[model samples]
Target: MKAVLAIVLCAFSAVGCGTRTSSEMKNIYKEDQDGVRRRDAKAEEMRYALSFGGCTYSLIAQNYAITAAHCSEESGALGTSGAAMAAGQKEAKDVQLDSLIESGLGSDYKIYKIKWTSKKYMKAQHIWTKFALKKSAVKLSIKPAKGDAVSTVGFPYDGEGQAIVSTGFLKKVSNYIVDPYSEIEGSGLYFNAGITGGNSGGPLFRASDETLLGLTVSGDTPSYYSPNRPESSWSADENDVWNIATPIWVVHEKSQAFRSIVQGGTP
Candidate 1:
């Protein structure tokens, strides 16, 4: 009687295992198709993304693009301004910016006119055409509320030259005063989207409408902070940090050249 009971239990366990395996097998093909669709959609959205100076930029017009002010040649932050390469391009093209239109110090945003000289004219046109065809140019939105879903498109250092997209929600909006003596005030959009060195100057888009919300500027690192009160204890955990972005409103408020571009006029 004990052997009979043991045999029945084994049979039931095998039936349950078989059922789960069959159900999972049926979903595998569907899951693969869904993944493919997502990848294709992301590729289309990032068609206008460009890589340059070990950072990312988005082509908003045929001859204009936006990036972080720190990424400009004048900043000396990245040391060298390298060639720019559009997505799907086999070779990078030597591109030059006419001038830097920055939103003051510490604001961390800039718009520049691409210099399309004779050598780069044809290729630049070709790249812009592809970008326009995909309607990848994003519109700017100054207002971003906390908890708003957002996405970032850029070439991370670890991405091996391929564009990587990260998604997160807006965590906070605050003023980042880099220098108290200089009295320079800037606005920052704090989010949790993972970003790295090469992602600097990349666009941070609102997930719902794809509007340009900000530009990726810095990521959190382990550091120390002190509060005014002596009893408070605080330490910067390497893991407990938020990625920051320069809100687009900073440029809108500070740069006249940026306004012209946004108003459908040449910068």
Candidate 2:
């Protein structure tokens, strides 16, 4: 059999090393190329599985939660549509999908019921990029910081072939996109790791006591074009590097709107 394996290389300007000046380990999460678990610290969190006609996103949040609007658009399901689809149900029906996600489905998944959707943010986006998780069953709100550690969970190439649970370390203050920085609050979470196409919208989490920081936004340097053609303008290889991701923090307001459904107490 041919030997096929996943490789994780770390070294980039995104993490903003040396200048940031921190004694902490800058690895997003330490994992083997095969994605085997040396530590399952973020197992308790929720994985927001998203699907799109072109791509599937985990809709990873900053607080160990996963969700994807693009995925819902392709599935014709929306938490606010009063008709969300279920894992077993093929038809898109008006029902809360969060409970199905919160129950901890036999080590394969964790169930989380949608009490109330984040209407504010969910409405502002192009639709595919705006969605969130909630359950009218909590209180209080806490803001995450720049250097907070977070974890990630997602289904890439069937969820097993690729590594999961990336650990993220804080990098710096920079604009991922020129002028568009204001669109994302002019701030971003940078980390060193091995993430790519299938990993988009995957969960980005924190494990100090189990909290979310953001989603798996982007990788160090990836091909803007097809991977097969490295020299192409689209290829984010040695010549061109492009890192992109929808910041989970953008939905903070929506999260606050459904404060009643905010799960968990402070650590």
TM-score to native of every candidate shown:
0.60, 0.40
The CA root-mean-square deviation of candidate 1, after full C-alpha superposition on the true structure, stands at: 18.1
Q: Residue-wise lDDT of candidate 2 within 15-114, one digit each (tens)?
A: 2212321111112123222221212222222223332221233322222233432222222333222112112222332223442333111111121343
Give candidate 2 regions above 4 Å deviation. 1-72, 75-149, 158-163, 178-186, 220-250, 254-260, 263-267
Clashing pairs in 1: none
**Stretches of model 1 off by over 4 angstroms after superposition:** 1-41, 72-87, 116-146, 177-185, 220-239
lDDT of each: 0.50, 0.31
**Index of the highest-lDDT prediction:** 1
Candidate 2: count of backbone clashes, pairs at least 3 residues apart or interchain = 41
